[model samples]
Target: MRDGLSQEPSIEPQIELTRENLIREQDGDSKSIIVETNNSKTTKNSNLHNVIIHPRLKPAPFKIRDAYPTDLPKPTEICTVNDLKFYQNEELPVNRRGFKYKLCKPNPIFTSNYYSTTDIEPYEVSLSWFDRSTGSYLSQDCKALTSNQGWRSVRSNVGIREGIYYFEFKILKSDDYSHVRIGLGRREASIEAPVGFDGYGYGIRDVGGELVFISRRKNVLIEEGFKTGDVIGFEVHLPSLSQQKKEIEEFVNLKKSEIPDHHTTKKRKTNTKNKKFNNIEDNEKFNEFNNILRDQIPTKSKGVLYYDQFEYTKTKMMDHLLNPITVFGEKAIIEMDDKTKNIPIISNSKIVLYKNGVKQNETIENLYSFLPTNLEEIEEINLEPNLKQQSNPNYKNNDDNTLGYYPMLSTFQNGAVSLNAGPEFEYPPENTQIKPLSDRYNEHVIEEWYWDIIDEVEAQYLDSFD
Candidate 1:
């Protein structure tokens, strides 16, 4: 029935399916046999049998392209564990917690045998002058401070939590509208405001010699006012360690209870596609990789030759006024629990004022009651925690040091004052028990020695882990 085939075989008819024959067969012959081949020309004919080809059915060979930038600069070399030894031998700049660096200064007092080998001159622990970095409108030497427009306050470099210490201040100049307020303030006290504008500070104004706390003034403390030439003295006495242990424990417990449970907090929903990569194992691996990468990347700031990371001065919790006092009895007290019996009390701490070496009759007492009682109160007030405290969980627990009070000075328009943290005072306190502010140098040396030992131990512990 086919034209290509013959019944008789007198001579075998030879035929080849060439391009022309295939084309001719395809044009008219529906019953033509189709052949599939690897050849490029046959590919088109391979689908001639009403067959459909989808683009997604067969994937094409892929060639990956470079996605990263080629012209990126190489990263600077980072410090490693092995490189720490080299840094120890060299004098490095002191780096504070908030990425701040203190400018270089000579320390004559720090001539200890421990630091004799290195050129690293440690900073003096004693309060020599007002801190220039922390205070505005301060002189270059930090001894004199002035305010032009509004109230500007400055705290001493060092502060004390316990012991009876005395310091003197002399008003250099004060205009007709200008005034000065001298007091002690915690780190949380605002420099932009007067010393006693907030709860964290307790001050006395020169205008009326009135006692000030939480912006409220009480004229009963000092009857006579001081002038520009008068030398004002402050005597601070804090409770000893034995008296504060129980109270500190109770306060710590209250703070612990106030901290909300992390599990109870609402969590953000993760992407469905990325759920597989969000597991703990993956996170651990990522952290490990990140740490390695960080070690290879430099963290040094510009112009810094060499430096060491140090914890910045931590800020304490803000205090609240227990009860508004109009007048004082035999003793001014702030009770922790008014209803509870024998509850730990924050009393006996006193602040004595002196005008021109003459001791004032009135003494401000019971200071601890004004300090922060619990951590919840701190959060409710929206107080910001320090960098170290925010990052380290155990920081609060380990730092049991009581809220320290620093000599704070505030001035009004065109007001100026000079500090006298001295070995020699123009008007020294009559009390022999109360030490001069210069005696803090001994305490500083002792504290430094203790810290040095701790640092050595920490380094050894880290080396063991490595």
Candidate 2:
């Protein structure tokens, strides 16, 4: 009785339990004892409002060519931070060592190479051609993979169609060939892509309007029939318009078939004896060795290499186009299909050095002065598209011919990604105009890596925190 009376409930600590009575309850029998002391310091109680930004997640602000170190991200505003400084001990948990950011540099880098990225590659090639036949889809034979064709490398690199590549193409031409168009193998154009991304990729067009050639640098030009032999190069753009339609029909107003790029060498009539000097070697090997030393004479002597003919058609264009050639350097000359004296543009499109921006009525040879002085600046230079403006002024779906631009569009609504259209490559000069991407229109919404090369000082600060 005395023990019960002496047990004062006020003095006897009545341990309280949380909602989880059993979980938080202290195991003590009316005895006060310490279990856990709040001695271990952690980030849980950190002053998030005043905490420094994490260096890992910090973003570097934008700047011009010459910027100061202090011009970097600085915590000026209460919310401003160079990086969101996350503590090592986080309750929710994140792998500290697993922290990663992507480092990518868009190809054909330009001044405004804007683009978006998916965790994975864009599955289907997507393109909305400027062609009039929108609803009706068509499939034509195309070799997007041949070396001479502009698309050879891109096809293999991008992983199109599973054997079939499950690719979609939109011809810029309104008409479909009675026969199938053949082969759009691989050709990639990551021209003027935004920094830190791969923006310039090729996608087939859907319209059959006259081809509009644009330099990688944004200079627009028109092409005519081959005068002198030139190396012509073009990109194969296989765009997946929509899975709903399988067949895409394209009719060529130009009446040229979509085939292989024609590579023909001029045939030279060999006098059994040189009409100029009759000691021409009888044996082929002797003539070959003689020709090797032909250049030994000051003026010049030449030889010929014979090859078969390959055909090509601009299904995407109302007129047939001679794609620009990849200048492997030096001179490249080819003859016409008929083996006539007509000069070919197929082999010599890239032959003349692109020295200057497109000039008014300037011959291709005169443009050689425009070669980039700085090789390092080559990556930033945009190549000129060897396409001429449509001959027909009343071209279909014609916009302002003087100020018109066609940017890459998406396939599905809120799905397809836009091509890189940025200004990282060349700085647009005054009086020049910029064609907005929105003018062309995009059906899908856009969503958006690169590594930070922290300086030694920055590295030390980051390591010190670690």
Candidate 3:
């Protein structure tokens, strides 16, 4: 016998049997046999008990219990405490490659390195500059300062030049919609104005939950600003060597632009006029006019000429440069002295702000270019004025390249804030994928994804069963 399709010999054996043989075969209980015959034949007995058949079965879907992850941390618990909680399990399950844990806990190594007590040292506020007599020193470390007057601020004793730093400010007391600022700044930042009121410093302030940049010349509104009880973290990254050089060059160029050349030209005109006039009376009149001009023009001290008359004295000019007028909008214009106007110096580096554990969005990133509602009105006010010119040597003494930034705090009347930088930091940052003050030029970090094959397998199995 042969198969009809393949035309090949059939594997089943030819059974030559009669009724007795059939009965014996059934009694023997052969499992599976294909009966074939070279000649025509028929079974003599019918026995169903001896025969068996097996069918293919599909596998059941994998069923995992809900209690698999018994140790996932709660977000509320993480928020209540000051210290950080870290988890070690970030990889996928060993048995199931398709499944993965999100590892929501903060990175332990990063958190430790960031809030390490070994790196940062303790510093106190300068009593000579801030209103120490009125506001109480809230912290035993002497880092925190507060005042109820319209505005009060203090500079940190330690200054930072290059390196990533993390610090925080906690609002202890303030009225509704109170102004709060946190940022890095130089000594030039006026003690009277908030931290970012001057171009030398950068700060983020709260105005109706909106973060605004407070600079000497401009007040730019950004995203949501922090309020009372909010722990605001600041990450200050100083400029690189190349960036510092570029900024220094820009400063030099600004210096050249600020000093006017008209004084020399006007003096030459007077000299030529005097040469033409031989009359004694005319000479006396010219001398009188020259004296008046000399008093009106700014005096040259060293090589730099002072332009802003309100900042006429050498000390006042230094104050104007260091302590900027902090008022925003048209108020700044109204407060400007009638005599002299000054422009702000924009820096190359920047800092980032964080609330709780999450990073602030990039929309409000740079505090240097922030502006309030009335931007155009603020820019029109001039900072330079014609004033009595005198020679002064202190104008050229500022060292642009070597200048470092110190942390500053300002308190409006009835507002108070506290500071923390390592050692005694009450609240450590929650998310620590990157170091503080590192990577200021990039966007926020995104989480990675793992394969989800379990869902597909379950769906396919259900469809087949149905």
Which candidate achieves the best lDDT against the true structure? 1
Per-residue CA lDDT of candidate 2, range 347-445, in tens? 111111111122223222100110001000011122111211122211111111111112222121111111222222122222224222221212111
Query: What are the per-model numbers of colliding residue pairs?
Result: 0, 111, 29
- Model 1 CA lDDT for position 256: 50
Q: Which scores better on TM-score, 2 or 3?
A: 3
Kindly list the per-residue Cα lDDT of model 3 for residues 377-427, writing each as its tens digit.
112333221111123211112221213566676666545566665533455
Q: Tell me the alpha-carbon RMSD of every candidate.
A: 28.6, 30.3, 34.8
The best candidate by TM-score is 1
Q: Give the true-structure RMSD of model 2.
A: 30.3
Winner by lDDT between candidate 3 and candidate 2: 3
Q: How displaced is residue 425 in candidate 2, in Å? A: 20
User: All candidates' TM-scores?
Assistant: 0.54, 0.17, 0.40
- Can you give the lDDT of residue 424 in candidate 2? 22
TM-score of 3: 0.40
When 1 and 3 are scored with lDDT, the better candidate is 1
